[model samples]
Target chain A: MPKKKSEESKSNNKGAVRPDGRKVDELRPVKMEVGVIERANGSAYVEFGKTKVVAAVYGPEPMHPRHLADPEKAVLICRYNMLPFSVEDRKKPGPDRRSIEISKVIKDALSTIVALEEFPKCMISVDMVVLQADAGTRVAALTAASLALADAGIPMREMMSAVACGRANGKIVVDLTKEEEDAEDAVDVPVAMSSLTKKIALLQMDGDMTLEEFEEILNKAEEACSKIYDMQREALLNKYEKEGKEVNINDE
Target chain B: MMSSKLTAEYVRSLIERGKRLDGRKLDEFREIKINYGVSEKAEGSAEVMIGNTRVVAGVKMDIGEPYPDMPNKGVLVTSAEFLAMAAPEFEPGLPGENAIELARVVDRGVRESGAIDLEKLCLVEGEKVWVVFLDIFVLNHDGNLIDAAGIAAIAALLNAKLPKITEDYEIVRDELTDPLPIKDIPIPITIRKYGEHLLLDTTALEEDVLTGKFTVTTKINGNICAMQLSDGMSMTKDEVLQAARMARDAATKIREKLFKDKLKELKKA
Candidate 1:
């Protein structure tokens, strides 16, 4: 049976039509599944509209190149990759400047939430590959990476979530699409926040916008993130709910 | 190298006492210098120095095919090279993550601010357009390479003059026309959060002890054009907003002070 993602959320910007007809504040349909990869210790496949990403977490295993070992804490490496055919243009297969920067920012966000101290002298690698991208791939990849990390039994201080917010037709909107990103008036900001505590783990933006406009869209993005976090928790719980197991996510 | 614990603790104590090793205020930046025409062969170039850190930015123009998505506009490619001569830690190989991150962040600040009027750079719509290559080189890396490099980029761009084109769309370097059309100036300021204290333009040692950092870029209107958050740090929403405010002020200060002499000379020439 094909899963029917919900898109019934009300529009925040009344009278303004989104490109895909989503509500101004509504996210694209999201589908998240955990442990989809068999060989990886933890994995997740997530989709937001046309954007699809798979994240895999491997090892608190022994560190390679022993000299790189941080005697005091585990080394966490994040790789954000886009497949060659992920986008409309055929991207060269490798770590390009864009992907390198995205990986660094994702690592920065996850580093704040993961309990890396518990796995000293080890290496934990989180990799996210974009199978298809529209826009907001960075945030989508971050969401899947966070889920994969949690599913890997990596200890965490808080549940993490991310979403992109920007303007289309002069109205602030959430989960921007490619057309919106390339729009003349678009001002995009990708935000990552703690699901429950609401602390900002990551904040990045491009495009010129007044401080007031940025603050407004940013607050909306945070609210959307909390909701996405709930969806992530539900998906994870569904995996173990079949066995009548209660996970201690405490996301509420 | 000091132990991470000892270094962090030392820095925290100093911050608690409201004192920096160099005796500058928490929000103070090191002395900054901006010199134009550093590269004799480049179309436009500048060298920026902040305290002991130094960088050179050079801009080269070439005619190239425009992207399919933005066929009527030109392209601006920003790149950074962390040379081994800049610091001991830098290796003599391809740019690792730091250089790539720096280039991307700076690129966003410029591109998103609409600093360059790329549409005007088109020679033939959908056929060819001018490509501006801004290459930044780190000659010395005490700390705060981002701010220094960002300043150099804008200065170099401002220093850039469009070369007169040949009838066949070739760039004629000999006949220069006007300055590159600049709608705005995007200046980026990086603030390091250390032990509850926000330090601006930190040194290498200060960077070593930083709990986190945020780089905020602003244009002439004081609106944010770009921003980047460093690793392993979390801040309250209020705190980030506060940092944005601080970045605006720092950018203004840097702009008004450092670029003063160069702008005057440009008008004179």
Candidate 2:
């Protein structure tokens, strides 16, 4: 017997099971590769389902534009670029207002762990390119860029990991895809944290939700980010292993 | 930072002893890392890190009028930017001579090697064709930017996909048709000669004291695609031939280790 359209819609919304069959609290599959760019001091490639991002780190070298050079510390710069065909619509090349805002936030988040003062009169640059984006690219870029910086052999107090959670349908969901992102009344909450200290480095929220729901989403994001932190560490360790270097994972 | 005479002399002395300050053999390259599909928005993108030097290359495709001379073939434009934040020496704004030279070297390698099958990119005979824009950025410069940039550019092209074109002539940005046809992989190897010693992948400090440098682009089939020589000093025919042989050997190793498996995986997708 054919089911009614209304009945089908209701059943689909009941458990908030996504089109890809992920539950409200589930995350998309993630893949990480470290030291992927041979020309950068450090580089990483990350994939969160269909969302893909690449990050490269270069520096502790002398800062350009002499005036911007801090005598007491190294300056950190982060740039994020999305290609024209990354989305359903073709985007123009170059930095747009949205990219500029995201770049600033990512820079601020990374500055927390970067021991900039250790290398005076120098700078560190982190460049991220989103080759394909389904959703949650900012978080993916942050996570990948941090790993790239680590791969560059930069001194850091701790590493940072990021993940996004949002309200889709009527329930909280982790790692929303583009379809879920476009749903009515959808809210996105992206959170980044210092892996060792467990302190929030970046927190941005959009849409509307109750305070309790927000707290639950944050908890879910934290849990997901923790898992990502391990993956980031593993990627870094694997690169060294491939180079025949012994890495003590517990040294941190 | 200016190169010090003391540092140059020290490097020369170390080279004479068959050693580098970083504790590497004269012909040994530093660690290489290549990652593709870094940019979600571009048709293709790659990031390459050779030791401390970092470069990112992104390929974008668009429909445009074909050139009168080559109406049937597609167009490939290459440009390079040396970000000011990458190094103290690099200035922002317009590309300097060094940046222009880097782009030309990479472009020559790809174009001459016929790495991309441009004929397949044509839409209309003389009216419309696909234009591939390959943009490279040097995010960090520890030296050997030419080799790194070339690798990134080629990898980005290998990773590229064509946007679906409807029968009605509408270009669909979201749906990808298939991977662009890649004919060959041309790998560039830059060698710096410091006094009598020839060094591979020179660091910035080493480059400052280099007597001369030459980059040879070799294809997977052990053929020379393009060659560039710069600086005041010159190399003899024998030296150039030796460099070519070395570059070919290195290209083969890189093709096998870094690209073979990845290319297979990309093809499967």
Candidate 3:
């Protein structure tokens, strides 16, 4: 299924049309599934077309004796992994350097949006595992994990969705795929945003874009994120409703 | 920790019964999976899995002054980090013995093979050259880190290409760049000696049965570049010779697979 879509998207790029014939602003199909992992405190599996991610949320529990607890804040630990078979070529099983860095960046990025002060002396861990990766995996993962945490009934100031806009073939392209990346010339501008206040949570970009282009794409991403933010919320609500029980724990 | 003496004896009994603790054959590799460009930000990246043993490798190229002694050659530095989460035994911050062994074995294989044409990486003779940093990370460990790390490091290097830099020193990366200065391709084959017999592709459990192991690295053209005899328990000349023969055959098979697969074609430059 992913292979066919990739081939179709490759042809679509050559024809100057958005893959799937959606508007430039339109996103590929976004689907979220929650409570997939029975063992984790909260869990979700999400897919944006061929890009798939599984997020497991654990903790808000007592920290190990060896780990010093914060008196006034909660700590969020995030680790991102991609299964070896997730790509066209089978990947190795372990975490790579890029994954480690992304894991750190993600932990820091989400820290800004989560209400850490609410859960003092507790730790929340989010493990985002990419079952398949095509493009925009980081964004897909960030959104999915946030929803999963909400589904798990973890408190937060707001849910976060990350996105990337890059200059490819001299034009601003949103969400690059492996093939499109090869065919075009571009620099990556990746951002993580909070849906609640419409504020930037994390911003990272590589390559050069004019200040005007940067602002333009940044605005586009923000607007796009608002729509994604809604989808993420709906997904979580639907997941809890499907269970036919309010699993919400008391805030205190 | 359990008693090493008792565990060692138990491992010997398993080998005698021809059944490994992990349910693998004496010569079978766990499961091999490879993924390329795992790091969206890396010049070249790959992750490989041999069963639960996972290694992620990425190649980062930078400009640095050449060493005074080796003015015309580029440099390749390999580093390995074993994360605490990868195994229950590994501790964060401080590297354990297994981690150190993993790093040294991988370094020896790549360095001794002379697979990379470092001289070609020199941008300005001895004054300026490219330094390729190969970083291997163990995220999960089931066993057999050496083979996994060796394959991941080279595969990542093979996947990597020089970034396009303009005259102004700004990166001009528009697409996948050119292949790195690769002269020869060398792959290492590890053989573990167990109870007077050597086996190919030992799993973590099988590794426990062995006193120690040795790896033989061979280049594409049947040239042996590096050999390491790991066990303190000495082996006679005949046993070493037999292991070399097994390694050569195993290496030949690995070489065929590397080329048969289209891993090297991802580069569009």
Candidate 4:
């Protein structure tokens, strides 16, 4: 609670510290499970440390009659939401400004990674729910939701992974947590990238940073994104391997 | 005081014969299945299926200024969408009364319970904080949305992890990962009062036949945090006490199932 201690808390993490007395660019912990829901096209529950997200992908079917159809492309709509009780504090339940913005951001980000041309005239509903949140939630959701889509066998140009980078007390940091976000005098930037193309899909920023600082953050984000990409690959591989054995047995 | 309505009589007959209008028992809860990480762009998300009733809850959070009235507290918002895809009853676009009521009920249950430590969300004493938003979508509707929504909401929250931060209000992308600031946990149990009977979970037909419905939410410490009675129904003193007791027991059972030893395992995975 003291200023000096608070700064120390920022430099030090929960229990473990980095070689530089700071936490390394490590994911809190990545855990995922498939088919937790019975009636969805595909579903997955992913946890990045304490940031938990549930991703459900529904449909490659007809578009709503009222909504205009994209003649040459598929429409992938993404809705990002959090339950009132998902956080430590109780939230009013409704579509507020933040949700609408996040939903739009997510939708735009996913468009870059999905092969919409293949499912022409079809619509895919990607719904992401935040049951809990820490920091880097958007990035975590982007990575986790993509894996869920893959689990459902949705066609994708590549898996999307994301991470947050920012300048805190003149230091660039990776994977911001709630505690650090509160203490640091810095700027936050969250970016999403396609693993296959290694191209940025979504870029958002808050606070202030110099051009050099921004470049550093981008470099850090790229490195962090690769790590997240590895995790996403591992998750999908684990799921497919498990399902492959089941498929082989069914064929027999 | 039996209404002479045929629908009421028919429902009573079904119950008397140990059959529900929807063919379920008095204490029977509809089947529930949950899938996590359904959205490719949500921080935490889950879909809950209870019989034909389906609800998906997702968590999304961002940094913002704390409210002046509650500087130490964070912002949490919950919204429910009763989609036309759920059933013929639900309309498209603008939420109906049912959706509004559902969102308010869940919101009150979580908010009044003081489940999360709001003060922890404070960054600079009203300067900034993390605003967590939860959205609920009713993908299908057979009945019992309260239970399904609650389950999905909590599952999504428990599955969430906090981001690491640095000194000066910035997120530390690489350095840390910790659990979100959770101080309280509330679980809701929905009860339907039928003809001289109290039911734990109800289907659509049962809901239609019921005189009234109420939900009681309890914290992990065995304290009742919030209550919502729908359809403008009132309960007798004895009925209220009995419902409270039933709700407490139900909450305990649900918590055991939802937060099983597997939560730790799920986190480690």
User: Of the candidates shown, which would achieve the greatest lDDT relative to the real structure?
Assistant: 1
The segments of candidate 3 whose C-alpha lies over 4 angstroms from its true place after superposition are A1-16, A19-22, A245-252, B1-269
lDDT of each: 0.86, 0.81, 0.69, 0.70
Which residue runs does candidate 2 get wrong by more than 4 Å? A1-252, B262-269
Candidates in order, TM-scores: namely 0.93, 0.51, 0.48, 0.48
- Candidate 3 on B140-237: residue-level lDDT in tens? 87767777888898888878988877675456555557888655556667777666666777766556556466666665555555544443223433
True contacts kept of each: 0.85, 0.00, 0.00, 0.00
In model 1, which runs have C-alpha deviations exceeding 4 angstroms?
A1-16, A244-252, B1-7, B260-269
lDDT of 2 by residue, B133-232 (tens): 9999999999999999999998899889999888866778877779988887888888777655678888988888765467778766665666555442
Candidate 4 lDDT over A55-130, as tens digits, reads 8888888877636568888887777888898777787886655666566667766776677788878888888888
User: What residue runs in model 4 are displaced by over 4 Å at the alpha carbon?
Assistant: A1-252, B1-9, B21-24, B163-176, B262-269
Tens digits of lDDT, candidate 1, B135-156: 9999998889888889999999
lDDT tens string, model 1, A1-252?
126465564444464478777778888888998888989988898898899999999989888888898887899999999999998879999998888889998998998888889988899999999999989898999999999988899998988999999787788999999989888788889999987678787888988888888888878988899888988897788666743544344433
Pairs of residues at least 3 apart in sequence or in different chains that clash in candidate 3: A90-B34, A90-B35, A91-B34, A91-B35, A92-B47, A92-B48, A92-B49, A93-B48, A93-B49, A169-A185
How much is the TM-score of the A chain of model 3? Answer: 0.85
Q: How good is model 3 by TM-score? A: 0.48
RMSD to the hidden true structure, all candidates: 3.8, 22.9, 21.9, 23.7
Candidate 2 chain A: worst 10 consecutive residues by lDDT?
A: A1-10
Per-candidate interface DockQ score: 0.77, 0.01, 0.01, 0.01
Q: Interface root mean square deviation of every model, in Å?
A: 1.0, 26.6, 23.7, 22.7
When 2 and 4 are scored with lDDT, the better candidate is 2
